[model samples]
Target: MAKVHAEAQKEQILNAAARLFIEKGFGGASMQEIAEALGMTRTAVYYYFKNKDEILTALVEEVTLRARRLSSRATSEANTDPKEWLRTLVHQHTMLILSHHNEFRVVDRTEQQLPERAYRANEEAKRAVLSNFTAAIEAGVKVGVFRVVDAKVTAFTMIGMCSWPAFWYKPDGPKSAEEIADTIAELAVQSVIRPARRQLKSAGDVSEALALLREDLDHLSLMIEKQPKSG
Candidate 1:
């Protein structure tokens, strides 16, 4: 019963903190406000988290863990095609952002708000995601499928393309999350792997080629999941 109550209180505080932070910015929001929001005293809030920085740290840890989980599940599946695996990666990455939209907002905006260790941990997760992207690009390049570009930068850009929607995406508005994700995936394919160089003449060829790329992406996700667990 104690553990359950604590868990419920933790969620209450996190939800309250997310709302306050979004409304008042990280530094502007205080432990007092958070505690009041939860109908508790400041000491109660401090019992679960010592300071505002702890809340910020918790937010990053939560989403990075979700992203890591997505990669783990996709990678563990038995598949060898790089294109298909990459598509899965794209979808998984998009899903993570969409499913945890509130946490995503907190993470996207408040990461710099964390202390050095927390910030480094957040960057480490990001690096793992990008490293997966770089590996996918390299695998495709070796297969004569994805062209040789600056894999590191391109990988980072690809992630930005997919991740930006979480910032301004609205569920009942212009486009659905899945629609944007598919479009981003398509654009990423074109940007990272040029069709002109493939020596393939038709759109069908592009589709077929990417289908084969999925395996490499899946492998990349698996590698990231195996990292020192964060969050």
Candidate 2:
């Protein structure tokens, strides 16, 4: 369809702009340069985006929107399973960074240069992602699955870990994005998971537990018998 084709063209422009923004700082990159990069005329770029600021804002919004949507979907799908929720969130986040490293890096590097609207949208998206992560961690802690820790702090830490890949990930690296994501996801899950301890077996465990209960009851009875009688 024509609409689909137009949307795809818009995405190409955004991708070209992201690369230019990374190579040249947001303030350094110009509309002409972005147009040239895409092999289009300056007027063509302008038709899609009025100015460099508009392009930058579009880039920021696209990346943030992607992350926010991923977080929402992961949270909803794993609503009943906090451990799975956290794992899914971390994995998806990691993949997002690696798959779109240029866009991620551009936004990360141009925070101060972001337009007012873009900045607000970025901050709101961040808060939404953090809220999902914190809530999931809190849920796990409540159910005694995750260790006791500051859920907000843990969420922030994991987010930082995932975001760092945007700076250093290489497409030709030994590990693919999915492999790296899997490793990090597992690490995040294990970090909060409750430590394992020896479990009581069905036979001896039940007998030992009952014996301890009986001892406590007998001690309570003795203490009550020793109490002075009321008139």
Candidate 3:
């Protein structure tokens, strides 16, 4: 019970720090401010985290590790449908951002504040996540489902689209996270899909189409000419 309570307290401290960081940025927020937010003494806050940097590191590492695990799992599921895989990836990422909006905002806005080793570790995890997205897109292209010019570029674009919500999402907003996720996923898939081909028309058919278009344009011009001229 003591162990569980200790863990809970640590989580509470992290949550308070994340909120403060989101409000004031990692550089702007101080340990005393975080402690005050939690209604705890500065020393008590220090008991869980030695300083503001430690709290930021913990939050960034936690989210990065979660993302890495999710991407690794998605990569391992080799037989998953490409479209479904992309949808699941976007949905899961959006859900993660929504659940940890404050942590994500801090990570996104204050990555430069992380310690050297922590920054490198976070970058490695992010690369792995990008790898999974690239692989999923490549699979879709190979199966002739996606029409991307470059899988890596498209993967980055889709990731940017999905991650942008972390900076702006509000819990009290009109749309739920799931709804936003669905819309993003659909847009991502559609962005890479090939457009349907139009039916082939022979020379005679093309001439007839052009003639019909000219007739319509001439009628519209006549209608415009008949309208009273404005002074």
Candidate 4:
């Protein structure tokens, strides 16, 4: 129960931080503003986060973690096809940004305020996301499913294309989140999948990989669910 409450409180701080950071850049949103948003004192907010930088750091790490957590499964599983894995990655990422657009904005726009340690941590999380793409690209190339190109560059390009959507996506715009996700998945697959290379592996091979990831996410979701409600 304590763990649950702690998680809820942390989320509360994150939510407040997201709103404040958006309304006011990193400099404009003070601890007092965040506490006031939550009807709490600055000290109380401090108890949860030492300072606004900490909150910003948390917000940035949150997005990176979510990105890594969602894709870890399909990428880690042995013998999974790269292109389909990229499809899953694109789909999950599009939904993630669109669903949590506010937090993602913090992820995309504001990070210079963080200390070197926090910045490195964010970079590490980003690297983890990049590594997954690199691995997927390598796997696809080896399996003859993707073009024999620069895996590192292609991976970076793929990830950049997928992760850059939080800047302009609209929930009520021309396309629903689902439609956008599908399009992203299709484009991602088409771009990377090698032309004339039709040696496709059955989904069953990737199922285990996907399940491995689902397990990780389920664990994460459960951990979040168990957190104490802090309203």
Candidate whose TM-score is highest: 2
Best by lDDT: 2
Rank candidates, lDDT, best first: 2, 3, 4, 1
Model 2, global lDDT: 0.86
lDDT of 1: 0.76
Clashes of 2: 0
Tell me each candidate's RMSD, in Å, in order: 14.8, 11.1, 7.7, 16.5
lDDT (CA) for every model shown? 0.76, 0.86, 0.82, 0.78
The alpha-carbon deviation from the true structure for residue 153 of candidate 3, after best TM-score superposition, in angstroms, is 1.2
* Residue 6 in model 1: lDDT: 95
Which is the winner by lDDT between candidate 1 and candidate 4? 4
Cα RMSD, model 2: 11.1
lDDT of 4 by residue, 70-93 (tens): 778757663555667777777887
Q: For model 3, how does the per-residue alpha-carbon lDDT over 1-231 read when each residue is reduced to its tens digit? A: 999998888888888888887787777888899888878999988888887778878887668878889878877875746878887787788788787878877787788878888788889999998999999899887766777559888889988888888789998999998898889988988888665233232234767677878988999999999999987
Error of 4 at 87 (Å): 1.9
Q: Candidate 3 regions off by >4 Å?
A: 1-4, 195-231
Clashes of 4: 4
Residue range with the least summed lDDT across 10 consecutive positions in model 4: 195-204
